[model samples]
Target: MEKHGAETYGELNADVYDEWHDIDPTDAVAFLAQLVEEGPAGPVLELAVGTGRVTIPLAAEGIDLRGVDASEAMVARMRAKPGGDRIPVTIGDMADVDPGTDDRFAMVFVVFSTFFFLMTQEEQVRCFANAARRLLPGGRFVLECPTPDVARYDREQRVEAHQVGVDHVRLTTVRHDPVGQRFLGQHVLITNNGIRLAPAFMRYAWPSELDLMARLAGLESVGRWGGWRGEPFTGEGNYVTVYEKPATPAS
Candidate 1:
């Protein structure tokens, strides 16, 4: 399999992103929307904002939300949606954290495990530093990421079924690299008509490692939750972490 670049996932999955993922944005939207209401006044930025899944609804509710994406194809899907065109999106690497605007944001976020797409610890740290640079002092940076599950793989590989239908079946085969905390996967869709495959690659870091990245960026962890609704993090499952830039610049 060819190595996937930053834009590969969005290019391949943009069309089916909403349908295949089927994530309920209710909790996520409510959580971020509340932050927008309570936090300092400025526009919000979302990294890897593919297809406007959460961006569209928040924009519809009148949040001054902007976006950055690596893929033109994914951004196009977002632009085609209602209200999507109104949300300014910069087509670029999320790790770059450059939305190509003069405005610093009150909040910067990368949800739905998108941060893992950075593919390296150095890149992830760079993303944190860049995101912090894009934020207002005292502003928040939020991330939604799942805990690493080593048990899922047997001998460094795992296969699972995602969907089963009369006309089609969807499955994923993943190769894990424990040393690198990486996963290379292929989503295989088999239909009566034909077969399609979407390649995905991620370098996942534990929340503790992410905390180090934040600290290196001069940000501090203010909150950690197991879910979007402020549930306690019991050291398992997903975590929604909030890091804050200090109100004053670091000496």
Candidate 2:
């Protein structure tokens, strides 16, 4: 897949994007903790934890934390942060990741849009299989991906604009190719001083496709929600899925 050889956007604009979406982990601590209650501050693995957006804060929670991302540039950028030094991160593809030997995690997570980075259906399934392999018996794998049917793009074009700081604002327009089902186009970061355009692209998978992948990985979906707040998995609600490893059966 192109994702393997492609330059990651996070690595390129780490500094700029981090400044914009500096979500407080403390704010979502309760939410994430609720998702992986079984993990209980045990080994927690975060996949594609770029720029420490969630890993930094999760580490602060005092849990055993490990993160992995495909882009070394992004990993290096994350390492440069205040708490980033503390989190052990591996630079490699999320699919078929091995965090450590003899240290399987109680919970594995792929947050934000990280799941979409896998451009191919097979690779996405492989990622699930890999996560399952890294989990302890009865451990849980939590995932968050936007429901594919939420909004269909006629030609697939949308713009997102947000203020990064007092004077800087980033405007991104995602253009999808209907034929190839690939994300493409340009993201323009405009400031009072000037404007910089960065090209962006990705491939997105449907929720059903993800389900098949999880099933092939020996995971069963036990929970679904709209948002982190535990909203019902309506067609409109974002897809939040929980897959569990089979518990060691009593002898």
Candidate 3:
């Protein structure tokens, strides 16, 4: 494999992203819509908004949702979806989210562990700061991230079955760099049509580390949950966390 850039994952996976991931956005969309209802009046922004999975539905329901993504291919796929082209999108890195508007967002969010794609603590911190800069004072920043479970791997490497179908099978290989908190993954899909390899790189951070990042961006944590349905976080599994920019900056 060659060195992967910020846009590499989306560029490679755009065509099969939605199908392969096959996640239901119902709960997530509802959770976000509720936030918008309680939030201040302003457009909402999504970072790493590949294929408008959550953005299109929010816009269809009359929410002023916009997006920023690094991969033109992913954005193009989104534009091809129903109501996808209507939402404004800026082609840019999530670390430097810019929608080309002076208006601040009521909320800014990145879902599905996409924030890990920043690949470094420095980039992730920059992303938090950028999200802060784009929000209205007192507005919210939300992140839907899974707890990184490194114990699943053995000696920094692991392989497992991802999907098993009558005519197709998929296996995933993972290599971990514990020192850097980075993971390199490759998905092997085998079918009568031959085999395909989908690769991705991510740098995972713990919730405590993320809280510090938010603080550096001048935001504070207001909520954390085990899921979007508001379950309590019990030190395991996926979590949805909300941070707010203070209405008044600290002296």
Candidate 4:
């Protein structure tokens, strides 16, 4: 993958990003609803809310929600959705956040493995700290990432294409130097009247590495899961970590 790949992805895939982004939209809502009820309530902030898969649904439940995304194109797509305009969304880097206003949330979340885009340990830790500052004391922060099952991946760079119906999805998974991880993304909806592609680039993180980041941000892990349904976490499973900001300093 080129250095500018992620910057160009949103513009390149805007159209299909609207069409197929919520492949499992309903099930996702069900899970988020469960999260809302089981965890904190009231105001919530959604990080990297690409096209509002979880935010829009959660907003419909009448929860006070604000969304943040780095992509203008993706934000635009979210605006066209059923409850889009009802929520306020900011456009900015997920790592830096949109940089200010004193509002906080009961919960802050990064979904669909969005956390990996930070690409560095420092940036990932910074994001946790930023989210912590945006929460009320004792608020929860949740992040989901695909476990870095480096074995299922290949060492060499590759460009592969997949299709969901007439929508053709192309992917480019390039292995970066230093022998650590891979970049995998799909370009969807190619055969329609003009094609739109959604390119996702993720640098997988081991569960232990992420736990440390959360710890440094003054957040502690309360739970880890294999999926959105809250399955137990493991080496081969996906990760859903729930961390809470201590009511006072960690000391």
Candidate 5:
């Protein structure tokens, strides 16, 4: 297995990320905009805000939002986009850096399985703690991640062709470790010119584990949905969860 960290994904995929992973942001943007509008009074922060996919759009909608990303390469791409420069951004590890002592957000969010990029239980817990510390009392931390599906692996490994075109083909290969709840995978893109590989590692947590992490960070589970549209979660493949810090005055 190759050794890498949070920045690896952006470093490898930044150039082609927006082009290859483009998804209509209308629904997600609308959902999050409403959340921010209804929540406490403060700016919003997004972790791993690569290419400003969701962040840029939200900012356009008049949300006061800031972003933090580990990769300068990714941040640069976001900076080049229109209105991207208006949104404050920090280049640091989301799990460890303080956005600002004076700045507190009403909402913090990690979307599109970015939570799994932390790659270990310890890092993930620290991420939750960091989010909590950056939020105002009664603030919300929202995470969107795919529910673990070990069944997709056969003999602990699986490979599937993701895309096929006349000049290019994309394939995904994954190796799972049940005990550690980790998925080590690589995306292979083969073109007429050559081949490119983008590797990824994730330490997945069960819903119960997520709840415990939130509790440790002084947050309580407030909502869980199967999708961004507020569909009820029923052990689905992907889900969104919201955790809120208590509004009670600190003793």
Candidate 6:
């Protein structure tokens, strides 16, 4: 396992990210917008806000959103997009970067399994601490990721077709380390032009582990959903978990 930093993900995937990983964000945006609107009054902070995929649209909906990412290339691409420059983005590691001196957000979020990108429990805990630090008292910290499906692997390795088209095919190969609860994934893209490889490594955490992490950061569980649309979480599929910092007691 080669050591890769947080910037490695964006460096490898930024160019083709939107094309290869585009998802209809209608439901997610609606859910987040409503969450922000109904939560404590403050701005929102997004960790790993790649290419402004969700930030741009959420900002367009009149939510004050700020973002942080490790990759300058990804941020540059984001800046080129419509309304991208308007959203304040800091180029730094999400786990350690301070949002600002006086900045406190109503909500802080890391979506699409981005929390696993930290690759270690220490880093993940730091990220939770950072989110909690940036949040206002009683503010929410939300995260979304798919549950680890260990059954999908054979002998700790698996190859699956992600997408196939008339002129292009995308395949993902993964080697799982059950001991570490980590997966090293290599995405191969084959097209008429050529072949390209993009690698990503993640340390997957169980829902219980995530809840413990949040609690360690002084956050309390508020809600958990199986999907972005407020569906019940049945310990399967993707999940969105929300936690809230306790409000300060009056003096």
**For each candidate, what TM-score against the reference?**
0.97, 0.83, 0.96, 0.83, 0.95, 0.94
lDDT of 5 by residue, 1-251 (tens): 45597789899989988987887778789989988888899999999999999999999998898888988899999999998888888888878746654798999998888888888899999999989988898899999989998998999999999899999999999999999899988989999999999887888999999999999998989989998899999996789999998888445
Query: Model 3 reaches what TM-score against the true structure?
Result: 0.96
Ordered from best to worst lDDT, the candidate numbers read: 3, 1, 6, 5, 2, 4
Pairs of residues at least 3 apart in sequence or in different chains that clash in candidate 4: none
- At residue 165, give the lDDT of candidate 2: 75
Following a full C-alpha superposition, what root-mean-square deviation does model 1 have from the true structure? 1.2
Error of 6 at 135 (Å): 1.0
The better candidate by lDDT, 2 or 4, is 2
Query: Candidate 4 regions off by >4 Å?
Result: 1-7, 18-21, 27-31, 34-42, 158-160, 164-173, 176-199
lDDT of 1 by residue, 156-235 (tens): 99999988999999999999999998998989999999999888889999888999999999998899999998999998
Superposed model 2: Cα runs more than 4 Å off: 1-7, 24-27, 40-42, 100-102, 149-152, 159-169, 191-195, 248-251
The alpha-carbon lDDT assigned to residue 1 of candidate 2 equals 32
Best of the two (1, 2) by lDDT = 1
Please give the lDDT score at residue 91 for candidate 5. 82
Residue range 1-251, candidate 2, lDDT tens digits: 34434346666666666665565555355667665665534588888878887788777767778887777778888889899998888777788667755678888888766687776667787889999888888888888776654264554677777547788777877776655556765668777889887655566776777778878888877787786777787866456778888876333
RMSD (Cα, Å) for all candidates, in order, is 1.2, 3.4, 1.2, 3.3, 1.5, 1.9
- Better structure of 3 and 6 per lDDT: 3
Across 54-99, the per-residue lDDT of candidate 6 in tens digits comes to 8899999999989989988898899999999998888888897465
Tens digit per residue, CA lDDT, model 3, 44-79: 999999999989988877899889999999999999
Estimate the overall C-alpha local distance difference test score of candidate 5: 0.88
lDDT of 3: 0.92
Best by lDDT: 3
